[model samples]
Target chain A: MTFTTFMQHLVNSISLGSLYALIAVGYTMVYGILRLINFAHGEVFMFGSYMAFFAMTTFGMPWYIAFIIAIILTCIFGMLIEKAAYKPLRDAPRISIMISAIAASFLISNLGIVFFGGIPVTFPRPDIFDIRIVIGGVSIISVSLFIPVITAVALVILLYIVNHTKTGTAMRAVSKDYEAARLMGIDVNRIITFTFAIGSSLAAVGGIMWALRFPALIPFMGIMPGLKCFIAAVIGGIGNIKGAVLGGLILGFGEIMIVAFLPELSGYRDAFAFIFLIVILLFKPAGLLGKNIAEKV
Target chain B: MKRNNKLNIIAILAFIATLFILNVTLDPYRLRIFNLAGIYVILGLGLNLVNGFTGLFSLGHAGFMAIGAYTGALLTMSPETKEMTFFLEPITPILANIQLPFPIALVAAGLVAGAIGFLIGAPVLRLKDDYLAIATLGFSEIIRIVLTNMQTITNGALGLKGIPGNANIWWIWGVSLAVVVFMVLLIKSSYGKVFKAIREDEIAAEAMGVNIFKHKMMSFVIGCALAGVGGALLGSLIGAINPLLFRFLFTFNVLLIVVLGGMGSITGTVLSAVVVTVMIEYLRVLDIEMNLGFIRIPGVPGLRMVVFSLILLIVILFYQRGIMGSNEITWEKLFDFKNRIAKKITRRKSS
Candidate 1:
């Protein structure tokens, strides 16, 4: 490949990687705290995009206003999901909780079909995001650059909240030991809710960015990306924030490069994520950056 | 024990009698529903062995079913039929001419599926809980993707049509009955107790000299074989097969049956399988536009799935134990239930 083409691919990979990182952080955060896979998370991401879609198309809101409303609504929706589907099974077996998450995911996607209609809708892309820029014989959509910037900004702000703030400390404490955190005056439920809210907003951001890049809205569109992002989280060492980012980048670059180099294997594009997932699971179950904790007898 | 054996014989006779009556009387559409229910019974029982009894959350049933369906379909289809189906890409020369009897094809399907299961389960069964679930799901999807891409072997996306529909009510129910009986015998054996022991406490089971991995592999392979048989029967019953036919949604439907029937209970699985299969067909009313002379309601395409998923959520949240709650329906339990009701009625009358 030529230098310009390679540069273009690198830019596109970074954009996709950051998007995966954006969503992976949510999976890592929730898994870190609850040790539950939160299978419904993909639906939450779908909900955010649809919410933004309706906000723009139905309510006639500006792009920025619609995005904000969508993110906030998604945050509330995530908390409601936890309260309704998960909280009741807090003390139940992990498998039950996981099943509940799966059911919730199925429910939302089906509901999306019933409510939003199954036909794919074209997302309203504002003029600014639609612009293409050319530099040194390489042309790229402005959204590609915008995606990475937005992801970085979001991550930086999230890191500030998680590492520098009191709530972040409580979140860490709660994740470490639920009962101990509760005993030490941490409102475990609230911290969990807060973590969900933060994670969800980031997913919303990722969803919106994803919609911008792809521009088609389907109720079930989140399934593949959701699974891929979770795989990314696992690859990065699921509970670690920096690890999620690194994993996302590796996955994003790996997928793009494979398709670029082996055009004939494009049909197997989806399988690559799964292959990577199984290999990582078999070889390094703890993930690249994750600490290996011993299983208790 | 003799009386219990008599009861079992009587129940079997009654079941056969009912099947005969239904086969003779029911319309084709209704009979097809019964056939579907039978397929689900086999599928649910297999899944129950893995998810319910052994407590290994595997989401790969659909993949094994796909393998079985394809294997069964390829073996049973006439050469002429295969020629028509593989017009886009020529059929592999070896597979093109071979045709086997339905019974042999069905057994071959199960064996092929079971062999694949053993290969997959050997590595995947080591992971616990959600990881295992995801890995199995990945394998299932990988199987599907491979099936979709291997156009020569599977006819790719066009799928196969006009396969011999030999999976009539007798074949489906007979296989289902055999599976149910096998499950009962397996669960009653010492091996079954070991499976339950592992489910309750893996460490304790291991400490007690149970080769936990061996038992898990055995259960997974058996469950997969059942899924394969179920898939093959379903393909033959419908007279068509496709990779899309065995998606994760298919697994979810079977999972719903297993969960609603109480995971570990054979009786529950059978009851819910029939009920769920019938309910899915009945729920089609919601998908079609209805005309009430006074008011017209337009059809909603996906409402049935929405309703079914909501039911799953409610069952998981409130009725976690499901219909049978890991308890099978035994003669003693039935008799005790009847006596308790009789005693309650007598006491109420006396009072």
Candidate 2:
């Protein structure tokens, strides 16, 4: 491949990796605290796209304003779902909660189809994001360049919240030991809710960025990405945020490069992430960066 | 105990009577639904063996079903139909002309699916809970991708259509009833106890001299074999088979049925299979417009799915035990109901 083409592919991988990382954080954070897969996180991402879409088209709001509103709405939506569907089942068996999460996701996507219609909608793109940039004979969409920058900003903010804040400490304590965190005078429920909020808002950013990049909106768009990002989170060592980013980059580059090299395997692109997942689970269940803990009998 | 024997005989008679009535009275559409329900019963019972009794959270039912579907369809279809269906890509010469009796084809499908299940289960059973689940899920996706890519075998993404309709109410219900009986007997057997012990605590069961791998593999193979049978019947019943039809949605619906039936209860699974099947038909009304007074409500295409999912959530969140909660309908339970009725009559007379 020529240098420009290679550079274009690298830029594509970085942007795609940023989107996966953005959503992977949601999966990693929730899995870290609750050990529940939060299957509906993808639906939350879908909702974010639609929320932003509706806010812009139906409500006639500006793109940035709609984007911010979508993020806030998604945070509330995430917490509401946790409270209604997940919180009561907190003390129940693991299987039941997982099923509930799955049901919630199914419910949301189906409901989206009912409300938004099944046909793919054209995502409203603001022209500002469309501006193309060329560097050394390589042209990249401005959105591609902006996505990674946005991911970095979100990651920095997330790191600050997790390291320098009291809520983050509480979240860590709860993740370490739920009962112990409760005993230590931490409001465990609220911390869990907060985790959902932060995770979901990150999903919103990812979803909006995804819609901006791809620009086609479908009710079920989140299912594949959601599963892939979950795989990403698991690859990075599920509960580790930084690991999620690393995992996302690998998965992103791996996916793009596979098709770039072997176009014949393009039909099996969705299968690749899942195969990677199975391999990782087989050899490194705790993931690439995760610490292994012995299972208590 | 003599009374219990009498009750069992009566229950069998009642089941036969219901099947006879159903065959005589039901329309073609309703009969198809009934047959579908029976197939689901087999599927649910199969899933319960792994997910409920053996405590392996496998999400690969769709994959096993697809295997059974393609195998049975290929075996039962005549060369003419095969040629027409596989027009995009020619069927393998060996599979092109082959046709087996329905029962034999079903058995072959089961065996094929069971062999693959054994292959998948042996390695993945070593992984714990969620890891095992994701692994199985991945395997199912891989199966779908392979099926989609292998045009010679599966006709690729175009799918196989116009297979002869070989499944009927009798064949479907008879096999389902046999599966129910087999599960009931198996659970009462010593092997069932071992399976339950593994599910409850695999490490403890291993300590108790239960071969964890052996029992888990047995459950997985048996469950998958049954799933294959169900798929075979479904393909014949529907007269079409496609890779897209075997997506995770089918697995999700089966999971919903299993959960609604109470994970481990055979009786509940059977009852809920019918209930869910009928409920699915009834819910289709949401996709048809209704006129009330002067206003008309337009039908929404996907509203039924939304409602179905909401019901799943409500059931899981509130009635977590489902309809059965590990309970079974035995002869003794039937006798207890009789005793209650008799006592109520005696009390009224005394009053």
Candidate 3:
């Protein structure tokens, strides 16, 4: 591939990878604390895009305001999901919780179809994102540049909160041992809800960015990305936040580069993430950055 | 023992008699739904063996079904039909002219599915719980993507059409009954005990000298083989299939039956298979415009699925053990219930 083309692909992969990282954080956080896959996280992403879409089209709100409103609403919706689908099953078996998660996913997506209609709608792009830029003879959409910067900013803020805040300490305690955390007077439930809120807002941001790049809004649009992001999390060693970012970058780069090098295998683009996941899982189930914790009897 | 044998014979006869009556009387549409239910019974039972009894969370059943459906379709289709379907790319010469009988096709479908399951299960069954679930799900999607791309073998996204509709009530129900019997016998044997042991505590089962891997593989392969037969039966009955037919949503529907029926209960699987299938068809009313005297409710296209998912959520939250709760319906329980009813009636008359 030419240098310009290589640069173009690099820009594309970074944006895609950052979007994946943004979403993968949610799966990792939830799985880290609750050990639940949060299968409905993808639907939350879809909800964010739809909320923004409606705000733009129905209310004619400005893009910035619409995004803020969408993110806040998505945060609340994520919390509501935790309260309804997961709260009651706190002491239930892990399998039951996972099933509930799957059911919740189907329920929300199907409800989306019923309410939103199954037809695909064009995502309204703000003029700012529509601008094209050239760097070193490689032209790229401005959003491609915007996404990685936004992701890095978000991750920095997230790391600050997780590492430097009191609630972050409580979160760490709860993840280590729920009973011990409760004994230490930490509100385990509140920490879980807070984690969900953070995770979900990130997902909302990811969703909006994803729609901006792809520019298609459909009820089932989140399914593939959702699964792919989860695979990214698993590859990064599931519960580790920074690992999720690494995994997402690897996945994004691998997908684009493989398709770029061998155009014939472009049809199998979606399979690359899964292949990476199986390989990573077989070799390093603990993930690259995750600690190797053995299963206890 | 003698009385139990007599009761078993009587129950079997009654079941056959009922099947005969339904086969002769039911309309084509209803019969098709009935056949679909039979296919689900096989699918649910297969899933139950792995998920319920063996304590493995596998979401890859759809992939095996796809394998079976495609295998059965390819094996049974005549060269002329194959030629017409493969309009985009000619089918491989080896599969083009072959047209086996339905029974052989069904068996071949099961074997092919089983072999694939064995191959997949070897590496995947090592992961525990959720990881295993995700890996299996990945494999299933990979199978689908491969099928969608393999233009010559599967006709790509165009799908297979005009498959011989050979899945009559007798054929489907007959196989379903055989599966039900096999499940019952298997669950009663020592291997079944080992499966239960592994499910209850894999570490302990291993410590006790059970080769956890072998039994898990065995359960996985059998379950997959049964799923394959169910898929073949479904494909033949429907007479047309695409890659879209075997999506994860399809697997969820089968999972619903297994969950609702009680994961460890064969009888419950059978009962729920019939109930869930019929309910899916019955719920079509929600999708169609209804004029009830004064007000007309416009049809909602996706309401059925929403409602179905809601039902699943409710079941998982409120009634996690489901209808049967790992208990089987046996002849002794039936007799005891009958006698208790008889005694109650006599006492009421005396009073």
Give fnat of each prediction, in order. 0.66, 0.75, 0.69
Ten-residue stretch with the least lDDT total in model 2 chain B: B1-10
Q: What are the per-residue Cα lDDT tens digits for candidate 2 across B248-328?
A: 888888899889989888999999999999989888889889889899988998999998899889999999888998899
lDDT of 2 at B243: 90
Tens-digit per-residue lDDT, A81-163, candidate 1? 99999999999998889889989999999899989999999998999999999999889999999999999999999999999
What value does the lDDT take at residue B1 in candidate 3?
82
Q: Can you write out model 3's per-residue Cα lDDT over A197-277, one digit (the tens) per residue?
A: 999999999999998999889899889899999999999988889999998888898889988989999989998988788
Q: Cα miss at A118, model 1 (Å)?
A: 0.6
Clashing pairs in 2: none
Alpha carbon lDDT at B193, candidate 3: 97
Model 1: CA > 4 A from native: B344-351
Name the TM-score of candidate 3.
0.98
For model 2, what is the alpha-carbon lDDT of residue A268? 88
Q: How much is the lDDT of residue B321 in candidate 3?
A: 89
Please say which candidate is ahead in DockQ: 1 or 2: 1
Which candidate has the highest DockQ of all?
A: 3
> What's model 1's lDDT at B207?
94
